[model samples]
Each structure stands twice: as structure tokens, then as C-alpha cells.
Target: RRLKKKHFVIECDPLVHEGFESTARHVEIPYLPMLVPPTKWKGYDKGGHLFLPSYVMRTHGVKDQKEAIKSVPRKQLRKVFEALDILGGTKWRVNRRVHDVVETIWSRGGGIAGLVDKGNIPLPEQPETEDPDEIQKWKWSVKKTKKANRELHAERCDTELKLSVARKMREEDGFYYPHNLDFRGRAYPMHPHLSHLGSDLCRGVLEYAEGRPLGKSGLRWLKIHLANKYGGGIEKLSHESKLTFVEDHLPDIFDSAANPVDGNCWWINAEDPFQCLAACMDLSNALESSSPHGAVSHLPIHQDGSCNGLQHYAALGRDYMGAAAVNLVPGEKPADIYSEIAARVLDVVREDSMKDPATDPSVPLAKVLVDEVSLLPAPLCLNQEIFFFMYLFFNKTVEDLDIGSLQVDRKLVKQTVMTSVYGVTFIGARQQIMKRLQEKGHITDDKLLYDVSCYATRVTLDALGQMFQSARAIMAWLGDCAKMIASKNQPVRWTSPVGLPVVQPYKKYKNYMIRTSLQCLALRREGDAIATQRQKAAFPPNFVHSLDSSHMMMTAITCKEAGLHFAGVHDSFWVHACDVDKMNQILREQFVELYSMPILENLLEEFQTLFPTVEFPPCPAQGNFDVREVLTSTYFFN
Candidate 1:
């Protein structure tokens, strides 16, 4: 067993082979071959144990391995060193087997030196130092950029504030200095883009002045004379000087003056557009007309000079108009009457809980009249159009409740529209009179006429409040209603019959047209409504104009029509004018004349072809047929 185990532990040895070419009679290849003897070193050099190849170590017991060295060419040995340089000294190791393999390949066709050259590893470029002054300059530039950004933000904020103040002042006071108006009395120097802008300004002023006291006469005066002054457009005003007459008295005169012709009075008139001279003369005459006792006795001049001074003051009002009087004299004390008025104005603006509150105290003093007047109610009572509209809208709101039909809840409608906040307040104040009338059994619904006036007052106040940014937020709520519907996929119903859908992108085109029309109406361009009517009239005989630029109800109808069309339905309006016979005749003729459908049967056939599931039902030819019922039902269904 010992002998067998020993035999299995036998020695191992590498295989070797040798070959010789047979000598030919005559052949010599022109090639030079050279042998390179391997070189090796072995010793301890900080790294431990050393070993070397046979030719390198040259030990007596080793066989002649010089043949292996002789097999490789001398040129290949240099290539090994070239590869060593690329592989880096740290990773390279010289061994007989590895050297032989490299050498054989290099000698036959390839060289390690070629790979090293191809790598072409480059030395890094040196970094340059920046000059101290240049570094400082860059730092300064960075600081400037930051500062500029802050300044730009500040400027934007200021512009926003200015715009807000300007819009508010425009809506509230209507105090505008016509910049384009030529004091020289000829044509203005510049042509304004918005021709009606001047009219808007004048209207704003008259509206502010009239407030609750506004009458039809006043409104008519504005309509006639608004564009006559200021050359029919918003004119630029020089902001250089202050005018006392304009700031202190123009608003009062506008309110109190009566038209010599028909007692119609407004803020400004074409006859005396810039007549501060005439206004001061009027004030002087009034002062002179008063019994000179209570406060006028200490006058410095006679009543005659007072009147003449009034004229002089009016004529010389340019000095004040062009200077610090627009706000106030620079060094005026807070306790001064002007300063006191300013303070009061600020207090009033702050205390106002209405839509727009004045946040800035530095508003021009001239606008105080507007600020005060806007807090009041309007005068004119609710007319049929406005009352009916609000009634319809409110009535539509309660349609979900069990009722006989979708007829308007007149009581709720009147309560919401006519019995508004101001109306209620007025009613509360006049409770005694109402109670007495009720006890006498003489209190009719007509007693609410006063409430109509109260409602108008509230509406006018609300309209003026819109000039203030805060009051206009009500519009945002109304605006969001559209957005809320748009965010939904289906129609939203407040009441069963009053279904509204969200706005869709496809419907938005027609919606935009309607909105544009309404905006034009609000701007008082009567031609827009007429133009739209003309366009619709071009379509068909039954095309009773359903879209009205001035009627909000009609606009809503248009929106609904567009929405229904997008929802895969078509709707049309034909009041009493389109009776059964007229509609049938029109439909027959429309299809035949327009697209050659001579009879109802022909139209029905075409419709069935278009919509295969549609079915037409038999009906009495004598009875009037509702087109809406037929269109929405299976009358023409295939």
C-alpha cells in the first residue's frame, strides 16, 4: 500500500517538441535574424523572495533555455520596454513565458510600441492665476447685478401701485385733466388711439358727481356733451402745476349747476368745457346774492371785485393747475383746512367697507369729492330690463324645488333684486310709514316703488365701487363660476331646468365672440348690437336675433347654444313668430331651396340616411307642431 501511494505522488514535467526543415537543393531567403539573450536580476530589494529564468540565474542544474531566448528577435525586446513605459513601472513584471509570447508576436508582425504611441497620453496644462484687480472688478459686477435686480423688483411694485391708484381714481372721481385738449383752441397736437376715451372720462366724472342724485336729464346731458369737450379722446395732462379752482370748486359747481334750457345738469358741458372763469363768476354772484352777515362781512374786497376776482381766478387757474396744488402746497401743516380735508378723506376711504377701500393716503386732494360721493346710493329706480333680468336669473336658481312649472318665483325674484341691501336699509328706516300703510290696508306692491329707487342707488354705488380693486373682486367670483364648470366633464345643474355646463375649448370661439360683443355694449357702441343682428339676419327667415350684445340673458343663451352644439345637439329659438305652419313651410323650403329637399318625406329620407336610427312619427297636419319636441324626440329618427 505504501509503494502504491508513493507511485501516485509522481513528479510532473512540461512537454517539449522539436522540428527541423528538410534541406532544399538551392534556396536562400534575404532576411536578417538576430537573437536577444534574456536578462534577469534576483535579490532582496525591500520586496521579499526573488526568482529568475534559467538563462538569467545561470544555475548549473538548469537546462539550456537559451533556445527560448534565441527564438525571439532583438527588435522585439525594445518593444517590450516601450510597452513597459505605457503600462507604468508599478504594474509591469518581466517573466520568461510572458516575454516569449510578446516577443513571438512582435517578431512575426506586431509590436507593443505601436499601442503605446496610439494611446498618446498628454501632460496636463498649467492653470493661470487671475490678477487681484480683475478679481475685485468681477466681485463688484456681481454686487451690481444683485442690486439691479432689487431695484427692478422695486420699480415693478411701484408701477403696480401707480396703476391701481390711477384706475381707482378714474372710476371714483372722474377727475381727469385732458392732456390732448388744445388750450390754444385749434386741433390737438396728437391724435389719440381710443377716440371714445374722452367720452368715458367725462362720463365717469358726471357719474361720480351725480351719484344717487343722477337723473335722466343728467344722463342725457352726458350722452350729448361728453365727446364735445377734450376733442373726443383721452388727452395727456401736464403734471407740473396745481389748479385751486379745479381742485376746490369744479365738482361742486358740476353738482349744483342747472341747464339753462331744461334744468339738465352734469359735470362738464361743451359750451363751457374749460370755463372755470364762468364758474368762479357764478360762485361770486351767489356769495353776493347772500345776505352779507354770517361769514362774508369780513371780506377784503367789495362784492363787485369778488365777482371780478372770480373771473380772474378762473382765468389764472392755470398757475394752480400746473403746480403743487394738485396735491397740496409742499410746506402746508397737517392742521390746515386742506390737510384736515385730506385726513378726513383718508379716514372715510379706510372706514368704507364697500368693494374698494383706499389704502393710500397720498391720493390727490382734488379727488376727495369723488371719494365721498361714491359711498352714497343711486337715485333712479329699477327699470324693466334690469329688473326682469335679475328676476329671470334668480328665478332660474330655484328650479330644483318641487313646483308646478318652471315659472318664475316672483316674490323671491323681487326680494333678491329690488329688496337689495340698500333697499332693505331704506325700508327699515321707513318702517313707520310702511306700518301705517299696512294697518290702513292700503299698502300695495306699488309701495315698493321707493325700493326701486333704493335698488338703483345700490346698483350705482356698486358700479362705482368697481373702480376700486377690492369691489371688483365680486367679478372674480362670477368669473370662477365659468372656470368651475369648465373643470367638470358634464353639465352642472343648479335647478333641474337651468343646467349649465363647463366651458369647452371648442365652444370658446363662439363664447369669445359673445364676450367681445358684451364688452362693446358696455363701452356704449350701439352699432355692435345692430351689426350682430344684421349678421344673423343674413342666415334664415326664422333667424330671430338670439344674440344680444347688451342683453346678458341673450349672451347666456348664445353660450348655451354653443355648448349644446359641442355636446352633439343643436338648439334654435323661434318665439311666436315661427308658428307650426310657418316652421313646417320654412323647414320644407329651407331643405329644398337650400339643399334640394322638396317635401318633408324627402327631408326625412335624407335625415334617415344621415342618421340611420332616426324615426319619423305620424302627426296631424292640422295641429301646430313644436319644432323643439320634434328635434329632441324620435319624430325624424331613423
Candidate 2:
């Protein structure tokens, strides 16, 4: 009955049997055992049962799934392989595929219901002495939340669109087929994700951008410029030219013979014993010596569609790019860092646009957007940051990360800085029909003024008759996100862009509920606490991730082209202090290019095709969101 050897952590729940207590020990099971315990297995202390370590594949020298499984959990290995065969082929990494298999199994009655039905666990009895009215209210909330989740899932998924893209990508590149677990068109981080593979305009424009950094230009200017460049930048390029310019161009750039090498590559190669000793040794070597750039072997810049809360906008541009990484050389600022980083970012974007990943961009894009945005808690943003602080705390450095002349606030490092975009939160709340925004998030110290640019911005309950304006812009934004999450949870099922199906097993919203009495007493519990929180926080975080990914990607490429050392932690881009100025300049220009295109309109167009039957609202006018307004401060990158 155990379909997977590596089943859910049953010991975590107290609902199981507590008889036959025994001393902690490790034993070899006979049956060509389905699950393999990790290398330093600590036997779980349950009456007499053993809870093996959580599944993990060794990071070193794992060339294939077979090699990977030798170290990772063996239970369900066959199931994972079967699923992968159906999904595609060995185009995915072992770790990621393992994760997918576990999730797939869990999603398909492998968790809550499986435990109760197969494990013979008894559900907690309903409280007999509780007040009836409170129970009914809890029941109603749970019902509504379940409904919302299902609807949101449907809005996010579009399997047909995804499967088509995957097929095409496989035909184009055998080794890499973009697949986000949920099948959103956004390419899995492991591969490239361009616009629809068949569209020349989309691919052509993308190539031009990737190959070079051109300042902001209208479509007309772009066409003319590309035309002047021997028509290589457009769909009209000779088949040979397409091969030479885009596909071949990027690989050439990453090679040592073609491009300059700057600082050493600095990456965490060791585990933190406090940090891993082995990784530290490798990082030490890279920091002291030079490494490759511009290719898959180095800091390969890439671009794809994004879901920066403004999916409508990322769709407009249709690509997110990250450049190469360089190590920080003490006081060694490479000259022209700005131009270098810009050139690298542009090249990567253009190249990736021509590459194309999954056909569907919804889920991959949403995942990227949703994953990062979920990292930000309004409380942390309005106060100080947590992630970057943890970094600084670990490194013991007090100097703020600087880009050219701008210094990033440590608090904003992990969380994207919310500038004028705070206004967007209110606009969204209104659109979603959020009625009492003022009553939502709390104000810090009862003062309605928020800190901004060495001055206080006078935020009120309702600015210009807006319902979502408040003391802290982050808090206001989160209030709306919470509403949106609740709304998304109200459905039974939804599909992702890549054809991954997500069906809710619960009949009510108990899984979406927090650590409240109802959840503690229910037959089911929200397995993924973080995902539940993201549903509550909503779009702002998604937007933040897209924006951050794009920004970092651009910086990575810029540094690669300029031949400067480039590495970063989330929002903080790291390079030799000397290259900071050029980093700023190149990023500014790239920012313009990123926004210059008609993104909002394009997103609407994408939506039209992705969800052909649904009618969407008119695209927001260009004036509605001015990049000039967003780029006014470097805080977003900080």
C-alpha cells in the first residue's frame, strides 16, 4: 500500500500510535528497500518507529538521476521516473525532478487522506462543548477560502498552451526543455524562456536586445535600427544569420578567447558548518583566480517573461535577464562598470528571447513572481529587513552595499523597495473591490507619515479618495494581497502553464487557515505554511520577485560584458567598488529598455491567447505606470 517509500513525515503528527517504545537506532531493511536513509541518519525517537531523514540528493558529481538516486530517497524513484517520462524526458535535474515527484505524490492524496486512510490514524473529535455560532462562522470562512483557491488555480493554469510549448522546445533543444512544476510559460530557472517559439517579431526583437544594449526606443526606431543592422535584428533575417547572430553569438561571448575576464567568480561552494568548509575552499579559489563568463559554464545571462505583480507589464517586455557573477576585489573598481553590465544584460536578454523555453508563460512566470514576493512581510519592510541582515550578520560587515553613488538600505535588500508603485496597491484593491482598506493593516506609532528620501510622505486613510492609502505603503499593499489570496482559494482546482494540474482535495478552507483552533481541530492541516501565507499576501510579492529577477539578471550580464567581477545577494549587486559607477549607468539605461516597450498592452495580448475564451479588461494606458516614476530611486534594486 506504500506507493512511495519516502512518504510524508508521519512522526511530525501526534495522531499516530505511541506503543512499543525503543532506543534510537539504524538498521538495514531487506526488500531492496524503497527509501534510503541519508548519510548521518539520526533515528527518530517514537515508541519504536524510525523516522528517516528528509530526502536530499548529494550536490557533487551527480551526472544523472541514477547517480542522484544513489544518495537520495529511493522510495517513489520509479514513480518519479514514470512521471518525468510522461512530462517529457531526462531534461530536468535529479533534485528538481525528485521534488516534483514528491509534490505530485503528495498532491494526489498522498498526504492527509492517505495518512488517515492507510496509516490508520484517527481524526481529532469535534469539540462538543464549543459554541455553535463560532463553529458555523469558522465553517463558512473555510468554505469560502476553499472556493477561492480553486478559482485562482484555474486562472493560473493552462495545460494545453504549456504542452505545445514544451513539445516545440524539445524539438529545438533536446537537452533543455523548460518545465516549471506548475507549467506556467515562464521557463524553469534551469532553462531559457523566450516568447512563443514560433513568433518572429517576438524572437527577432528579443535577439537584438540580447546582443546589445540600446537606449529606450519606440517600435519604429527599433525596426529601423534593426533594419540598418543588415536586417539581422528582425524576423526577416536569413536563416543562416539567425543561427550566426543569436544561437552562436551567446556561446561565443562566454568563451575566454572572445571576451575579457574580470574578477574571480565567487559562489558558495561549501556548506555552512557555520558555512561549509569544502564550499569555502572552492569559493576562496574562485575569489583569488579567474573563471569563465558569458556561457552556461559561467554566469550565463538569460531573459524570460515575468510576473512582477504586474504580469500585465512583464508580459509586455516578455523576458527577464540575469548577468554573470564577479567577485569583489578590495578597492579594485573596474572602469566603465555601467556600460559593461548593461551590455551583458542586453546580450543575454536578446539571446534568450531567441532561444524560447516553455510555450506557456503563466505558471513559470507566476511562480517566479509569487515565490519572491512572498518573501517580503510588510512588517519587515516597514521596519528593517531580515534576510540581508542575516547575511551581514553572518559576514559581520556593516558597510551598506553601494551601486555607483547609491547605497542600498539593508532593510530593503531582500524586499524590493516600494516607491511610487505603492499607489498601484490601492488601484488593485479598488479593482478587486476591497472595501475597507483603511481598516486593514496597522500604522507604525500611530503616525500617518512614512519615511522616504530623508523626508516623510504624508500618507492618510484615503489619499485622493483612494481606499488603500495608508501610513506604510507595504502594509497597504499587503492588505489587498490578503484579500486576493482569500479570493484565489475559493475554487476546487486550477492548471499551471506547463500542463501541471493542481486539484484541491479538501472540501473546505481548513488547509488555508492559519494556526487557529479550527485548523488544529480539523481532519486536515495546511501542509505548506509558506504557500498558505503567500495566498494571503497576494500580488505585490510576485511583482517584487519578477522585478528583482530582471534587475539582478541585468546586472549579471552588464558585469560580464564590462569584464568586471559581478555577484549579488538578492537585491544587492556585488562587484569591485571601482565598477560601481558604470554598474549604475548601465542599469539605468537597461531599465529604460526594459520598460520602453508597450508591456501592459502586450501582457493583455498574451492573456488573450493563453485564455482564449476569457475577455480581459483593456490594457492600462502607458501613462498609468511611468518607468520614470519607478526609476526615480534605486531602492527597488536595493
Candidate 3:
């Protein structure tokens, strides 16, 4: 006997299919008459096979099933009242409950996994393959290992050798030395007999041999060398190792904002390799020690924690401040070490940026990137607006954009997305682009337009795939173009080491000024006397003022008082100084007094086009010119 399959039909009307089968057939029938096919319709005497009884046929006495079925509409049209009732009642409410449940889960981070079972997910498992033959053929080999511990005398000898070599290198060459002799993997320390120079210089030489830049490469190499007997290659280095390298090279790589590089904002220990070297040299010079070794040997123990490498490029004063916090003795006054370190580090970087590098003729831009990569330390978390602006600054010319004069109309978008500070800024990527553009003297804020131009350039270059090997070639071409534009007065040609210089037609415009000046001079000399005099008179002045008022003003407000103070003797002032105290005080006062009545009125008027309805109370024209009262009132109202 076949197992019975369960089925239930929900009826639209209770009377529709009622009594279709006779009592005898309902009790036990071979098949249900209602479900029988058309061929078996003859067998179903009452209920027609594949067709139900129609109400129209019952009323009109229509005999044929086909004709009866044709009389009824295929799609039933609901009465207006029924439709209205459904709309007004629970049908929508039930659906809304379902939607709410869906929304709740979606808002709570619901994903595809919730609706799926592991078996139904269509995941295919690979068939296991075993290679018994290969396993049997595999051979195991034993290698001899040595475990020799250095005796006390040997260890002492090694340390003495390392220290001596470090001292010798410091004296002979103007190179830095490492503080320790312990190698990373090797049990034996580097022999003093092999290297007379200090550890840091040796590390630099090793790095140079490894085909890397002199900046972070040396530090990274040292770290790796310390970690292993045979140092790992750059590609093979671990992620943590790379970060450690960045930390080590931070100060040298990111010396200033202008020279921003990877790991620029990181804080590390005080006595780093770079600082140690500089400190040693400074101490040597100050003590009038004849030899570097003698100086190093006679130097006092570092009472304060040593300078960290990261501290070398940044404000050492900051490092010293932090160190003082940690190094404080009970009831001891905070040492003035911060000021000293700040002075030293500032002096070092200042002189360094001014120095010309051996690689190129370009002037170092008053700052050195402490790190090789500017955005290396997770640069992706930068603000979108900053990134966008930086992108434009990098890729486009400032002359093409009047962004400073342009105003953003909407308050919300302006504050949240477009403005500086709170606005979204992509730090690393923007920095990369901005630095590139600033090098070309194009620093403007029309970021989107610049991005569009960059996109166009990329698309154009992509089209030129057959002409160029890479996009870098296009950039190199642009760099050359920029050079020509900058040096229009000077003519420069690319020259081979042993071959004659070749003139490039692409760079012919480089002699623009010379050619124009010579042509004008010749015309003046050769033209008729009257024409020459007229030409001379027609020549424009040598210097015309810049179009922008901000730049042309020659002076700017650098300081201000705050909080409704009546002006007595002092007005707001501006001064250029490297000191922090005056600047900080001015900033504090400005922040406090921004809403003074007169200033508020000026601001309201200035921004009237952008923010109307803002008003300012008038300042007293009486004794001491009560600017503070106006400012305070404006502040209170606003």
C-alpha cells in the first residue's frame, strides 16, 4: 500500500465544492472527482473533471461545462465596498508587521546567513586526495647544530671591541654609532677587528649594499639585522618589522609638516639612535675632547632618558615634556629640559632643510620628510574633504582656481563636508597629492575640479597605452613640462654622460623670456625713431600688484584682545615669531572675543549673502572705545 500524501485546500466559499462527491464515493473512492482530468470527465457524473460548477450555469440552466465556464470572467473584479474594506482594515496592518520585523533585523545588521541553512547554501566540498606513494618517497634528514655559549671573558671582550669600534668610527668618520653590540639571530657579536666604524655607520653601509634609500632603509636594515643573523629582504620582512622600521626612521623621515611622511605623528621613546648620535657629537664638541672615543668615554651617564629617533625630527621639547612627566622625582620641579631639546632639534632640522641634497639641484623645502612614505601609518582613515582638497592641490594649478573667493551656499554641507577642521579629510592620499602640487606652486581649494582634471589625465593616458609603458612615463612628461614652464627664462637640455646634448622640441618654449625679450629689444633698436620711442613708452611696468587683496595688504592682524574689554592703549597686533607664548595667547583671546558687537556686526555684514538675519550691536564711540561691550552683546544675542 502507498503512503498517503497530506493536502488541504482552503475554499473561497464554503458551498462552492460542498457535496460535489456522493456519500458512498466520499467514504471510499478510487480518486476524487474534483481533481480528475478532462479525459476522465465522463466518469464524473456530477462534478465535472478539470472544471467546477458555475453559479451562472445553475441560474441560466446552461448545460455545457465549456460554455458555462466561458460565461464567468477569468479575473474576478471585486466590488468597490469590499476593496475599500480590505484597504481600511487588517490586510495592510498584517503586511506592515512583516515589514517592521524585516526592518528591525536589517537595522540590526542582518545578513544573508540568517535566511540560509548550511546544507541549502550550495557549498561544494572538495574530494580528499591522498598520495601514499609521494609520502612513502619523502625522506627525512638530520642537520648538525652547535650550541656554544660564550664564556664571560669572551663576552667582555666582544663588548669592549664593539664599544671601541663605535668610538673609532665616531672619531674618524662623521657617522653615528649604535648603543649596543647584540645581533638578532647570531650568538656571536660582530667582531671589532672586522669593523672599526660604529654600528650605525656599518648598518648604513649594509643598507646601501642592499639597494635601499639612506633614510629609513638603514634603520629598517638595522632592526632586521638585529632580529636575524641573515637579515630578511624588504619584501620578506614582516608587517610588525616594517612598522618598527617606520618608528625608527620617523624623526629623520618626517621632520616637519612640509616634509610630512609616514609615521609623522607617532610618539616614541626619547633616546633614539639619531638623537644619541647627535648628542654624542654635541657632548664631544662641548667637552673639548680630543678624540671622539675620548669624548664618548668621558661623557656622563644620561640622567634623563635618551632621545628617541622619532624625537629627532619633531619638537624634542614635546618628547622632553613627556619624559619629564615620567622621569619626575618626588617634589622635584619640572626640569626645563623640554626647552633645551626643542631648541636643539629645531636647530638641527632647520639647518638640515637648508642643506642641498647630493641627489638633485632642487632646494630642500625648509623641511625634511621624516619617513619615506608620508601616509604609511594607516592613511585611509583621513577626512574626505581634506583628501579632496589635497587631491586638487596636488594635480592642478592654483592659477586656474579662485576657490578662496568662491562660497558654499548650504550651511549643512559647508560645515560637515566642505569646511576645514571638522570636514572629512583623507590625510595620506591628500597629502601625497598636495605635496606634489605644492612643489609645482599650485595650492588651491577647488578639489573636485582638480579631481576631474586628474580623471581626464588618467583616461587620456589609458588611451595612450600603446605609446607609453606606464602612467609614470606620463607623469615624468608632465614634470618636464612643469620644469619648462618654471624655467622659461633659462634653456636646459638633457645631456648624455659621454654624448653631445640633445635638443628636445617639446622643451623649445623654455627660452620663452629670452626669445621674447631679445625680439622686443631688436624691434626697439631697428624700428624708426618715432616708433622706437612709442614702443619704449608702451612697455608695461616691471611689477604689478597681485589681484587678491589678502596678499597685497602687506600686513595682517596677528593678535587681538577678548571679552568686551574697552580698548585702552593696545590694539590688536600681528607679529611673525617662532615663539609659542604670544601666538597661544592671541589665539585664546580671539577665541573668547569673536562675538563682540562691532566684530559681530562686521561678520554679519561680511557674511550677509550667506547668513542673513544675523545682527550686531553697536560699540560705544565714547572713552576707551568699548569694543568689548559690542563684542559681548553680539555674542549673547547670537
Over the stretch 1-638, how does candidate 3's per-residue lDDT look in tens digits? 99996655654442332222112122322221111112211111221222433121121221222232333333321121121111111100011211233233333433221211111122233334466654333311111111111132233333333333333333231221111101010011112231212232222111100111112222322222222211112112242443454344434333311121122311112112222232222222323434422221111111111121111101111222232322211111222222223223333334444676775322242232211223312123122223224433463221122121111111102121111111123442244333444443333455543552243223222322322122222223323432432243322122111111112112111122234522422221211112222212111100000001111011112322221101000111111111112333433333223312232133224333333343323221222222222112211110
Candidates' C-alpha lDDT: 0.23, 0.28, 0.23
Q: Per-residue lDDT of 1-638 in model 1, one digit per residue for the tens?
A: 46652222433221210011111112232211101111221211111112211122112221112232233344433322221111111111112221232233333433121101111123233235487877676676667665664454343333233223333333232221111111111111111211112222211111111111112322222211221222111111111111221334344444434332223333333232322222322333333444312211100000001111111111122222211211112222111121222233333433442333376332322232123332112211112222223323443211122111111111212232222211233344234323432443322465353443333234333422322222123223222332333333211111001111111111111122234522422222222112222222221111101111011122223323332100000112111110222232333222122212112233234334544543434211211222222222111110
What is candidate 1's local distance difference test score? 0.23
Q: Which portions of model 1 show Cα errors greater than 4 Å?
A: 1-194, 197-483, 489-638
Candidate 2: global Cα-lDDT? 0.28
Tens-place lDDT per residue, model 2, 499-547, is 2222222222233324564333235443322244444343334444444
Which one wins on lDDT?
2
Candidate 2 Cα outliers beyond 4 Å, as residue runs: 1-537, 624-638
Model 3, which residues run further than 4 Å from truth? 1-452, 456-579, 591-638
- State which candidate, 2 or 3, has the greater lDDT: 2
- Give all TM-scores, in the order shown: 0.14, 0.27, 0.15
